[model samples]
Target: MDYGPWSLVVDAGLIGGLLLVGTLIRRWVGPAQRLMLPASVIAGFLGLLLGPRALGILPFADQLGTYASVLIAVVFACLGLGEDPHARTFGRSTAAFSAYSFAMYALQVGVGMVLAYALFVPVFGTPDGFGLLLFAGWAGGFGSAAAIGSVLGDAGWAGASSLAFTSATVGMLAGIVGGIAIANWGARRGHTDRLGRFEELPATLRTGLVPPGDREPTGIATTSASSIEPLGLQVCLVAVITVAGYGASEGIGLLFPSFSAPVFVLAFLAGLLVKGLARRTPAWQYCDQRTLKSISGVSTDVLIVCGIASITPSLVADYWVPLTLLFVTALALNLAMFRWIAPALMHGAWFEKSLFTWGWATGAVATSVALLRMVDPDLDSHTLEEFGLAYLPVAPLETASVAVTPLIVLTGLGWTIAVGWTAAGLVALVLPFVLGWTRTRRRPPDDRVEAAP
Candidate 1:
């Protein structure tokens, strides 16, 4: 009924409880240990089962679905503050990784269109964009889901957010479980030179706790607390960027009612603009990357919880078959690309790099990095170096896909996602080989990291 800011408080309280319980489960449970399940994932599922719509236990508000959009805007707003918008890294390894990464972004979502038309739309009378949940969730994670959900939700599909959330949760589960199994398989088959065993994985990974001596400051006090709190300064900056972006988006919509831009896209652009201008001012000294990241991380966690808990059991049951088929398709695509094709695309540290890609392809960058740490405890493969630099080129592609995906569905251009991204991926792959930037075939494993040329 009629609610106010207190509803926000109540929702926050319930989610907080769930997060605590989820954390306890991860700390004590065996399966979460094996799967490396994040607390947000567990909490969201718990909320789904116990929420008012399901068991009438946790009385959630109607505004829960909307939280994902808002939180993702915050996440996007903070990203530009810390990012180097300039195109910097483009070595051969970077090109190959970029191609592989682009393929994940493209085909994962592209194939969804094929499935929607060929199977989901016909058999289930589902909308053409129904299968887009695979890409929105699998390739982009919760933040992408929030962006996609906000778009589709505004377009009159009420259940879009829940379906997308479900897809994201499933993708995360599959990515972690499969990544672990794949890492072990590669180690056994002589694909990995690092020889990192699962048992040898750091305790912090499983428990999300660093030993006392290992703990580090989350962010620096760039500004004196007497002037302004460091974390508060970061939050204020994020909020300003978010508001500016959303205001511009609204202005654009009012000027051209036929056109609309995703708030996340605009917020990201706004953050970049704010960052650029700030670079020429004294305020640049106050903006800390770590502080910005902390804000982004908090937004992501809350967004995941809200997004996951927003799932309607009725909606899930209604589309169980198609959702299942869609998830299976995503898993199969990742398996083929990360396993069979990865070696052919890289000269060194193929497994580590590919596994890292697999993590982000199915989930997010955090998942990928964690998977990388598990396999390369010492970071000897230098896969992060390759990815950190290699990702610069394809970063725009990733952003564009997030911005355009809902439009692809809303505008009846589903075939473009299917046909266009596939062609682009093929071109990206072959062009590297054609330019002699990367080899066209897999090199024999030799336990040596190649210098990117």
Candidate 2:
């Protein structure tokens, strides 16, 4: 058929069509950004079903893989840019937040690993294969899962794809459910604190990613650098930071077997370091906040689009049960954390701080922001900024907690799945309030305000 060029065009058309559909779905769903799941999974499934992998009408499967790289980079950069160093400082509240976040992931991972180990040896009774390794390592990182799956698939494990698909679906759903619960809890409890007097909300993430004429210069201002070229030098700065961070993290990661922290976590810490270093450089002072804003916006959009494009529908259909369990557990945890923990830790606040915390846990910052925005559409950008920044600094700790536990595969699927259920049950019924209350008491309140200026 000699449809090489035609394949490329068709793939692009398909992706674009999916994007439009996703956008519409997002708006309809209300959060607008949360639709990344449906859009990406549906589109990816369509691609797989219709691509060379299945229908052979579009041979763009390889192309989709290439785009995944860009998606990862963009996501990492945004994550880095999103961190707020001021909020991340080792204050009592932040320290407590960090500790609690780590504990949560640790518990989940620990339970997951134990379950995996039991299932692998007793039911499956095979330890020498790549599937076992992939399953265990994947508990630490989805990337690891994908890598392991492909490796095992090559080694002739039939369910390698299913495992990878299941993990991702579970993780994403966990994120969303967890985020929503936190937001609602916060809404009910009302953890409201005004922005500190010393702080000014940031207008943008960096200088290079800003689109020209998209925003009025006077309308945005957080620092002196806010006026530089839109999407200019800042983009270079972000790219440099991202690459350097990725390299450094990867190097450190290799030193430890299960310590595969997300590259985005490293990039975020690097961005904070760069921002701090710039404080010393006169040139750094000239860096524009608009660049940050532009970079953040663009990267977010690209990542979302690419993520949707990368989804594989078959995975969702096959592994819906476990994925559903993970999501439900996350949602319950979010609520329990707020109802029991937040007030004790962040005392003297009238509003439910747990809501905000859940948003970060489940959906990361965007979902949190969406939660807040839904409550207050006029919610100032600074408030969102403050919360966004607060979330960044916790990335490393969260990654570590999630990665520490590894679950290998097993033949006894019933007992293995049972472990996951039991863990989820405990998390749902107990840990949230226990950890939340402990953190509340151990950490003293700082005079710092929680809300934005």
Q: Pick the candidate with the highest lDDT.
A: 1
Per-residue lDDT of 15 in model 2: 74
- Residue-wise C-alpha lDDT for candidate 1, range 136-174, written one tens digit per residue: 888888888888888888777888888988888888888
Q: In model 1, what lDDT does residue 185 have?
A: 78
Backbone clashes in model 1: 0
* Off by more than 4 A, model 1: 85-89, 258-260, 438-453
lDDT on C-alpha atoms for all candidate structures: 0.82, 0.46
Q: In candidate 1, which residue pairs get closer than 3 Å at backbone N, Cα or C atoms, i.e. clash?
A: none
Candidate 2 local Cα displacement, residue 311, angstroms: 3.9
Model 2's number of clashes is 45
Error of 1 at 164 (Å): 0.7
After aligning candidate 1 to the native by TM-score, how far in Å is the CA of 62 from where it should be?
Answer: 1.7
Please report, as a residue range, the 10-residue window in candidate 1 with the lowest summed lDDT: 444-453
